[model samples]
Target: MTTTPDPGAAGDDRRLHPWSWLFVLIGSVRQFLVPLLVLVIFGGRREDGVQLAVAGVAVAVLALLAVWRYFTYRYRIEGDSLFIRSGLLERSLRQVPFSRIHNVELRQTLLHRLFGVAEVTLESAGGSKPEAQMRVLRMGEALALERLIRHRGHAAGDATAQAPEEDAQTLLALPTAEIVRLGLVSNRGMIVVGAALALASQVMQDNLFRRAFDFVRGEASGYVASFDCGGPSLALAAIALVLLALALLRVFSVLLALVRYHGFRLQAHGRRLTVERGLLARVRSSVSRRRIQAWTLRESVLHRLFRRRSLAIDTAGAQLQGGEGGQSREPPELAPIATPAACDALLQDLLADAAWPPRDWQPLHPRAWLRLWLGDLVVAALLAAALCWHFGAWGLLGLLWLPWGGWLALRHARFAGWHVDARLVAVREGWWSRHWRFAEIDKLQALQLRQSPLDRRFGMASVWLDTAGAGAASPPLRVRHLPEAQARMLYVDLGREIARRRLRW
Candidate 1:
């Protein structure tokens, strides 16, 4: 007789189902208040006695049903997959295979922690939401489940593991010193300034500032009224000092957050890359070699001052979580950050022995800068003219913004560049500093080759690559001023890859 053990049975032993009593108790507690409140209102001596009894019985039935519903829900593991069976009226089954799992996120809410339960979210490549969420599980089981699924998917789209070791490319981790530096470099002071401004605006009853704050918070409107300035200049001075203090606090906060995530590390462990960072809530993110759709290394003006660059990965999967937009394929999740020069060296080394090719090319045409300049100038002029026509001299104050717009436009144009190769297309752009980024043809999601009337007049067009994981972030790559033929070819290539993936789906 064959002696193979049942894989499903082994997995079931490690599987967990939440305490049914928890759900039932939650339902019971919530239900208790409503009926009790109604009884207090309606209960009386003679006429309402029967009605009260009926209401009490109805509430008891509902509570019992809720308890039964909770007990009926169950989940188990089937080898490298998760199986869920849940229903009170009609049965339903959800199966999530390990290969399709994108991320296994563990969340511990306050109640969950108090109850010793952890929520496990199994995100997938195709689903709009997590394919499976064990809403509640013992902490131990949740951790084990995360480990098993991550380990079992070694052959799937993971990158860190498959990075070529023989090539001797530098792998980076944020050191304590660097992390501290990053924290210092971060602009946390701005946050404190903003907060103080908001509080002061509230006290002063500045509707404009209050509205701006409310907009960011995604809330409904609040009462707006003017404040009485009863205090004198000394009071104003004290307020100013408080504002200054708040600004300092914000700076520290930014530094602390940066330091916490500083010295970020990325290590290749066969086929997946694992990233760990946190000041408070530790985060571990992983990406596979095959999922790398494109790469972007960006330098802001401040980063230039420090001779540093921030690197972000634009991959084939959805963006890293906490993304607020409707689900779609997103730009790459950040792998690790490094210096600009280090990025160039790292790219060269990593792609040196790869099956596909890397890129080398010229910056965008010089005329591109002129186009940027004119676009900004035209926009400013139109806006100024419109304001002058509408609001008169008060509107002309807006035109004071022209010089700043011009500087920003020129800065943007200065940094935009593009490179071409048989296997890859790289487009680089930024303001005051540059980012060199590329996407391989096979990994392209969708291509938009667009020409506005102005662009056509200038014999210019833009090419945008819509890869995976844009989430709520800005687009991953956009190359303006490419030749029409080149844009067409790119569009066709990208379309084919998108179609292939759709067919697979």
Candidate 2:
């Protein structure tokens, strides 16, 4: 049921580990937990018999399938391609040419850590998920397979996929201290805590959390009935509770960062970047320099306070969703935390041949502040008025914080700038959370110039770019609220760039 970590285990051979059933068992439990929880919440004791029967059937089927999967799944390298055989009742054989593979990732879950095995995920272009996934291979073998695939991909065309030798230069390595810093700089603490609270809320009525909730709701006669508190005291108590929750969430977030980014390292091999990280579930993944579509530099409120930035790249592999990419799906990250100078260096290193620096930043329209923040200003005014109407003199305190929102709008206006160079285009925006994003000028799949009713009134327009497979959520680059002439000029320039520069992707 349990296995010890074995770092030196060789994965050069093609075989699944005997202990992979443990992973299967865990997976089955997770798959069932949500539905089981829902059933218990809805049916209670009345449907206990049906629940037990359904659970029993589900467990038995999952267990049998797990065993069969472990027995049936096998992966091997044959000549220039990787071959996989899986499934019991309906056997399937898949062969992937090295050229077609975009990325190969080695992921180790808690099970892999225990059994000294890793999951190998192969990703190709245009699919719902990863092309193929070989679970529970020895760590050494996984690396070897990835290296072989990289070599094949290189021989086929690209030379800088990855080099799994000992002499690759280390680009960045984050120690435990930086991981803690990353946790502190991240805003995910509250999200984790909120998720846990939501999970607690779904407990069965007879369960401990449910009982506690009922008591809090005055089910316990003395709980709320005996509460004799002034309005100010109640408000203070509510605030205290909120702070306590946030504190706990932050602690949880720190632990998550510690586990996730323990021993995180980035290495460079020619034109390839390799990343290895995680404490319990280690991952080793590599991306080609050419595959990267764009770069994003983010500085959250906490990050700004700490003077740190998180740099990430959106590669073809990150955007691609072929078949079942699974663990191979994560995007390449330069550094989770880095200084401004380090960021500049990393960006330069990545774009060594293309362009050195972008052109001078041209700011958005001067009246962009009114266009961007007018709605927020109206909402703030409405809130202040409503509060004053309800609480009279006391509500006037809301006006004290009104200036903060106005100041943030000013900050947003000041930070909004864009630049277009010979090879790259960049955009910078945001107030509390600052962002600077860059994309290749040549890779512009679509360029749009538009004016909304408000923009028309202000005689302004916006210009944005898109890459292949990129959704509306995050375009490669967008510069909003520019003057109509400037927006149209940039739009025409991009069209010329698209025609002049040959597209690689």
Candidate 3:
């Protein structure tokens, strides 16, 4: 008789599935609250109460459904594959082999934190979604499963049992002071300020900027009436109030940053990078070293003075866990705030063999500024004319902004350039804020070269770079107004390079 062990029984000894229903039900009820809130806001009391009763019954039904799903859902790891069975009515099944699993992600919500469990997803290299997910596993179980997958994925993705070695070294920690520094350095404060403004606007039923202007007008009127000040004094008082409002807004943003990035830490393992941070709630995420498709470095003029830069990474498989836009494809910040020297050290450690941001810059056409200057001047002139129409002779003062616009155009042109080598390509651009993007030539999916009628007159062509995991709506990088001949040569060279390299994905 042949003897074989059943892999489905592998985790039967210690696995727990009891809490999964609670977690799923909680998420469903949270979503259901929005409609109830709408009913409360707009419906009559009697109608609202009746609707609430109906909602309660509906939620009870959903709870029963969630219970059924929890009972049915089960997972087991055997040999080199994970088998998952879920869904209450349909009874879905997925068997993801270790070779197909690309990334293992662990996520926790507030309830998970309170209950000491987390959700785990096994992402395959297929596309944007995960191949299998196990919700509300005990912390220990989640971590154990993650480690198992990583250990297996490393060996399977490559030919042998070799995987990226894990150093398990802590790379960075944001102490109280550095956390404060991060708040000051990051633009995310804007998110907090934006949310505040949105909430306030909704409550007041008015735009925040308009509300501020009304407040300023009221204060200015009172000052003018009491002090007998002329128009200039009134203008100055109004400006003062506006400035005060702006200063307070800035402070609010910094505080928000402090709350969001508190207790942030970065750790590096052999081929994985992990980030942990949060205030009231905590977030922990991992990025595989091999999955990094590209990186972008960003710095503003203010960021330059502080010697600070932000780095973002693009990865394959699924979208990053958290970022500004909620679009999984957005390149989430890897090092949100850091010095140039620190970034260099971090990159060297993370991407040991990758030649990133090649320093040798090949300049764009000197006349690249021509289009920018003309474009900005046209905009400024249009604005000045509109001001004149509104304010009459005084509107001629608006023309003074022309020089400022001209300077911006000049600055943008000076920083626009690119560098290319056999393995890496670095693109630098921006007017007020500068950004440097680096990508592997082999990673590029496609390239496009085009010329507008104006560009044709100047014998210039624009080149757009396409890479995997970049969303369909926008190309990852663009170089505008390069000499047409050079652009063509670049196009051919890039295509050749893409064809030459072996694509691991």
Candidate 4:
């Protein structure tokens, strides 16, 4: 079954689900959990009776506010704008035009699912926060509102009254096995472990590392005493333990991936693409195809080992939302984990004109390896000097980095290349961990040609292409260590093309 809007009820004001106050209360409590915990822990002290009273008052105030908000908040659709009236003492009315809305997000937690409701957020460009957020709405009502907004409130005759098709064509659907591969390819486990360690260090009064090291040492000493093992055996045992810990972390990562991306599906409805995923807390989000600013295809060493790659796209209004409450700021991934051939097919289907996997990739300057190696050499030298001051002559071993750096630089320079066609400009770089960043020529917002003293000395320069909504995690679309003349030619050509074309976003 699908949501169908009633044409006659378009102008009537609507209240959220009756249980919205409960969700709002839960959210407020979560937001203040830390402060409340602190107060409760200290409240037992004879000298801190005031804190106890304050905590009690705060809880009551929050509950009252949640209920008041539910009673006061009202919204309605008037022509092409969503009109909202809220607040009791400081009354406010907001009108958000449907044309200006860029994103409509529907979130349903486990509790929300039990109640068959969803939280709706309406977002627009250049806003620090969502334009409007409905705490809770019936599943059908939320879907109906989303459909109304998607059509910009201009659906004709029976179109607005009709239900959406239940069997819409799905572009992609990830299975549980693929999610496990994604977890294996990602360093999310390491990231989570590090964050946990950092948090523990902050929360504990003792030096967390010192305590951990002491505990490990005690356990190792006991094991050695019990087994009567030699130093070599102890060393092997330590290595085994380390490996086991890493394995456990990988398992944790797999569990996390399953929880976040379970039943992940991507669907296309006309010019818009929608993604729905999550195990405990379902999220449904969509972005217009035209709002996509840049695209990235990433393949790390692990990804290559698993025969997988991921494709991510940056959309125009994503950066403005700030992703409040620990939510992801990164734009949704088009493909979290897919084979090379699958990735190529998706790109071909989505961006047919640009040509998938350009064959005519132009290499950078022949001497680019020299420039890359020189930079690495200087860094190695500085590190060696710093170590020598601390460890005397023994520290010269730090120079061992030179050979590895030189090899990497040579390989990177050999493989790095750029491609430009009538519709798209793309750059690919890296050796062990590789990625390709590209965008349509019309999506290009800025072009920069940069040269440092070292670059000038090497007679080389770099060109950077900027696009709207570029994510911090994504690599810059830069062609580096190019001959001065070639760099200038590319910069001028791209600049002229960008100037001639109107930016799509």
Candidate 5:
């Protein structure tokens, strides 16, 4: 005779939310009905009443079965892992470790928003598989689950590393009003919303649209009038009126877009960064100081004229990772948190608060000037010649910038400089619009020393520090025009530190 498994062990493997199938059945039935109805309508050759009834019964039965299976789906927590068991005949179990969690994102779709449900997603860094996602969670439960994970996963040293609760000063905290102003100035929502409205309108008017087809085939458009214009002047007037209406609608769309995306705010509370934005659907995201991968400071042409800059942080795998960082060695992550001067001030304040020693300031090497100009000249000349050959006289526009932009690039490259200390590395680059990025040496992942053929001839090399996720696939801090030997020595030092401080996954 064989001994049975312990009841505790059996119970640990049990699942919850057996009633979740009710929602799933409802959703499946809703999804199946439209296609079934379409088939009934289009299969005109059949004796439809009997066929329709049989199909309806089949759909209903399948929907019921789906609902039953959904309700049977469950999950259980065992030690530091969560085990999910799903499917009816083809049952399976998935186990996820709490330590594997990198980020827990709560998603609210239109349906979830209406039902007050949430979708919880657990992301793992450098995982072999995609992140695990749990759907159909109540909002409160999802948040609670996320909090529990964070509490469990946070390192023991995290508490002591936090800035002093009593003495810590808040800096660069954006007021709600300022957030609103920035949102308006940025106008991202206006562009996005307008495109959405245009798409929606096109879909509604298209003949292939489901609703449009239904309208035409059913009694939905019986009273609609057909346009039969006889005069050119009246047609022209109508066209003009339509254009005017479109212009007014565009203006209104912009206003609506602005309202919905207003009041963006970012604050530095001790070592953590907090961002909150959106008018209708507010979002609040927070990250600890140590999690930040890089820092980016930017100024657009308009902002440059206004003497303002945006400060952003690059948190690897965060929202800021997709964009290109202008003249920066670091991967794009955080950015445009504030204007130029404000960002610089914020950086200074952050360094002081962290108790990190300041970096040793140094300008771009003198050889950098020659390299910049030579590279720019060669590139610009080739581009100009190509444009002229293709476009004939019209390519003068491209030719106009042959020397001008190249000269500017060279000038800017000369101004680019870097500084390093025992704890921090800061790189300053760009000309009229400058950028300053700073990170701790402990955060770096790798160091690269490079030498071009011309650079070898010049006896110079470029040094790059790969910070956290910054490298070939991402952005990193690169300082060009160092002596070859000097770059190698620095690379050696960085590699040694990287080995000492590196934490393996």
Candidate 6:
């Protein structure tokens, strides 16, 4: 490991690794791949030679630009801030103060590892983009930079004088078995399959649906010819084929999980929490304990089958990158998959103050079931009416949805609840795919009390709590279907508590 230089020193500019130009070139190629493919496939006219020459010139220009970028980009650490200067025709300089930096991310792809280099990104709160991004730096230099930022608040002399290796307590580490369990509990395979099908539809000249149907028909014909069987046998063969496809999908999911979380580890170093994971593309991200805005515990039917759950956290800088090409913006996962007991213990260890899994979960209003059922009833009635208009009395079958919806609503009402303690407020919903979302009283950014027309009829209302850095996909922290009086009281009390406490993030 390379020791970081004194950040207090001035005029020590540094350029990125020499191989950064290659990475830049690769990125440019990816952006232009489609156009290049078009030229290769269709440029066969009389001016073919001229077109090829133009393409070659363009490639050369891009290569030169990549090299130029490498030569121009420079950074230096000076007095509690990082100064960066880049661009030629569009000259610009940026200074990022250490106090404002919230997260430091290091990513290393397989190619980066081969070259002993990594990409670094510095994130801050409320930023639409990273405060600073260094394309490629020596692995040791990247670590040194991370350390420098991690201890920027320390006295100037201690920043660089600290030992290279700080004691880190490993909070969680996942083995291959745990990763496999995560694969089984996740729907990543389905997502991958959907994306692949979409890509095939766009890239293949033939109609994708037609191609699939023809392939399936040919396979069925071959199977029937080989077995010399009738409808029953053909049906069985089709079932077998479907089962085989499902098995293949599961295997793919397992492989993906293995590749992404192969050596996952979460460690605590003083007040910082660091997560390191991935096989081919390693990522190490660190966030301060005070930066976390909310916590979530997730469990699905699949998780129950495996007796496992996952924990994730929303940080103040979670969305700082805003879609950076090489960086992920998803909330950090503390445990991808762990035994329920293990997850609880980890939560207790981290939170210590707020009790993990609140014991006294207050149920919603007794008529909350009716409120839920009525909402679904309106949707089901509209659907049944649409079906009835299209197909005579046969549409009455659509009404069957009413009973099923009512049953589901009742179950959800029974399972959904909320809990409030001095330090934290927690809410849980959903019976089949349940999740518990919580945030400290000091972390709550806003509160809302909502009452729909139907809710009014039932004399019920809902309380919603907002937290900074909550992912768009995360469920709202809502206590729904509470008695109007209770909801109002809870809302006012929470608002007062939030106002009294200083916001942490």
Q: Give the winner by TM-score.
A: 4
Q: Is candidate 2 or candidate 3 better by TM-score?
A: 3
Cand. 2 TM to true fold = 0.84
Better of 1 and 2 by lDDT: 2
Tens-place lDDT digits, model 5, residues 188-233: 6556667876765553435456665577556522422233455685
TM-score of each: 0.67, 0.84, 0.85, 0.91, 0.64, 0.89
In model 4, which regions exceed 4 Å deviation? 1-8, 42-51, 153-164, 207-217, 224-226, 325-328, 385-390
Write candidate 1's Cα lDDT for 177-245 as tens digits. 555545445555565667877656644435756677679555321211133444585477557767887
Error of 1 at 57 (Å): 17
Report the lDDT tens digits of candidate 6 across residue range 309-347. Answer: 899998877866443453445677889899889999998
Q: For residues 34-96, write the lDDT of model 2, one tens digit per residue.
A: 887676556557634887777778878888888888988876666677778888899988888
Error of 6 at 386 (Å): 7.4
Model 2 superposed RMSD (Cα)? 4.8
How well is each residue in 174-196 modelled by candidate 4, as lDDT tens digits? 99999999887777888988998
Per-residue lDDT, model 3, residue 409, is 78
Question: Which runs of model 5 end up more than 4 angstroms from their true locations?
Answer: 1-73, 77-100, 109-111, 128-130, 159-274, 282-288, 314-336, 339-359, 390-397, 470-474
Candidate 2 local accuracy as lDDT?
A: 0.74
Ranking by TM-score: 4, 6, 3, 2, 1, 5
